[model samples]
Target: MRAALPGARTRPSARARRERTAGLAFISPWIFGFLVFTAWPILYSGYLSLTDYDVLTDPSFVGLDNYERMVGDPQVRLALWNTLQYTLLQVPLYVLVALALALLLHQAGRASGFFRTAFFVPKMTPPVAVGVLLLLLFNGEYGLVNEALGAVGIDGPSWTTDPDWIRPGLALVSLWSVGAAVVILLAALQDVPVELYDAARVDGAGWWRRTRTVTIPMISGALFFVTVVNTIAAFQMFTEAYSAYFGAGNSTYSNDAALFYVIYLFREGFAELHMGYASALAWLLFVVIMLVTAVQLLVSRRLVYYEGEQR
Candidate 1:
């Protein structure tokens, strides 16, 4: 070969080119699936949001009417308010419960593995099943939860029927699936240096003091991750609320309390066949989640601590 000129780029060798082609071929299926299933649907949904389609007819462009309708829609406002209340009630409670369980497991030492598995089994329960269980457990009169409360001479509210208590009941139900967060937090706890605890103890720090000053800051990254994940999940809550209150033959409960945003979206799209309107609702949810996550990330910079990160 002639000597290469300055700044001249060299072509890949035959072997390198073949390897590159093979790598692309190997990942082609995933790339195709993502494009068809994820990317296309997302783009199409954005387009659909600007149209009026009832699934039976071709879409007619409606500009921003669907979005505008949401501004004055009582059901949309109620659903959004319900979803917001549930999320606010659920996220902090869920995080605290998960953290408490993680701390307990951390102290369990030899029994941690068994307890971890037991706790995680609930997370594997289907959401529909969990919803059914929620009804049974919080039935107000004869439910096990009320029965337990009665043992201490306290009466429990009708969780499924009472509007005031419905969101709290849903929040309590959310705590049942805290196992994944517990596992994550436990892993983070394990990674925390023992020397930190020892140093704190040497400084006469009590358990709570050490946890507040040393433990929390060290595991702040994991705490932040758990909060963010749970926040998103809470905002998107659907199956459990739907199965519990919005399902066919379930008219006894107060639906307004459980009419979460996703449940309304599902009803609009599939039940009522307002596909375009549902698409608009879906896009609004996407924007809300993105904004909320951005806020969390911005706040986390001041809270979360990472190893080797400069103060």
Candidate 2:
């Protein structure tokens, strides 16, 4: 190694500078888009949350008034409760369905690819279409669901008309698009070491015991990811519920059971033109999601297993 002068500083060669410039040029579009479309909008919404703005007039500063109003709003409580119920009902069922599908496909050998694709096809369907499909399948009288129940000598509840069945019906409908989680979990399952299963088998572990002791722990990270993502999605549920119960032609159906947080936020912002209050609602949701995610992270430290992580 050659000794360098004490005061000398190294400079990038021409090639290095050119490569850096090229890299920056390649990412500039994404940087610009993030600033304009994502970052700016989030900052602006935060500012709007503290103001009183209806689209027609300029935003008037309101400090904590909007948030205070939320504290007293019965509809806010109702919406939050509905969302919580939906999250609790849907997330576990969704994970179980996705995991079941993933496990079945994992054993499918050469046919796994075909089955995986088939399962994922529904996930590509538009939310609006899914909402319409929900109405059709769960219609009070002539729907396919009730028809199938009738075949088994069971009576199906009026899913659309009855408020009591609405949340459960929506939760059931949400399972139709668990493909992404299935794919994630399937990938995680594939990554688990064959040696682990082999060891369990050698110890006379049965299928269920081996799965409980080996398979689940190996994929806990993926399970954690799916749970967090699904929870957030549940909280933000809007388009499907809106289209099913609140859309122009669907207004005849009962909406109280399906009045999710984001649907209420959408109604306040777009329908009633209470943009400021909607922004506050959005912020509150953001804070809640952040807190919930933080708690999940804390819990995951104990529950989630990572390969090569320090014990």
Candidate 1, 1-311: lDDT as tens digits: 69989999989999999999999999999999999999999999999999999999999999999999999899999999999999999999999999999999999999999999999989999999999999999998899999999999998899999999999998999888999999999999999999999998999999999999998999999999999989999999999989999888789889988999999999999999999999999999999999999999999989889999888
> Which stretches of model 2 miss by more than 4 angstroms?
1-22
Q: Roughly what TM-score does model 2 have, to 2 decimal places?
A: 0.93
| Per-model TM against the reference | 0.93, 0.93
Instruction: Return model 2's CA RMSD, one decimal.
Output: 2.5
Candidate lDDT values, in order = 0.94, 0.94
The Cα RMSD in angstroms, rounded to one decimal, for candidate 1 relative to the true structure is 2.5
* Model 2 agreement with the true structure over 1-311: per-residue lDDT tens digits: 78878999888999999999999999999999999999999999999999999999999999999999999999999999999999989999999999999999999999999988988999999999999999999987999999999999999999999998999999999988999899999999999999999999999999999889999999999999999999999999988998899998877888888899999999999989999999999999999999988999999999999999989
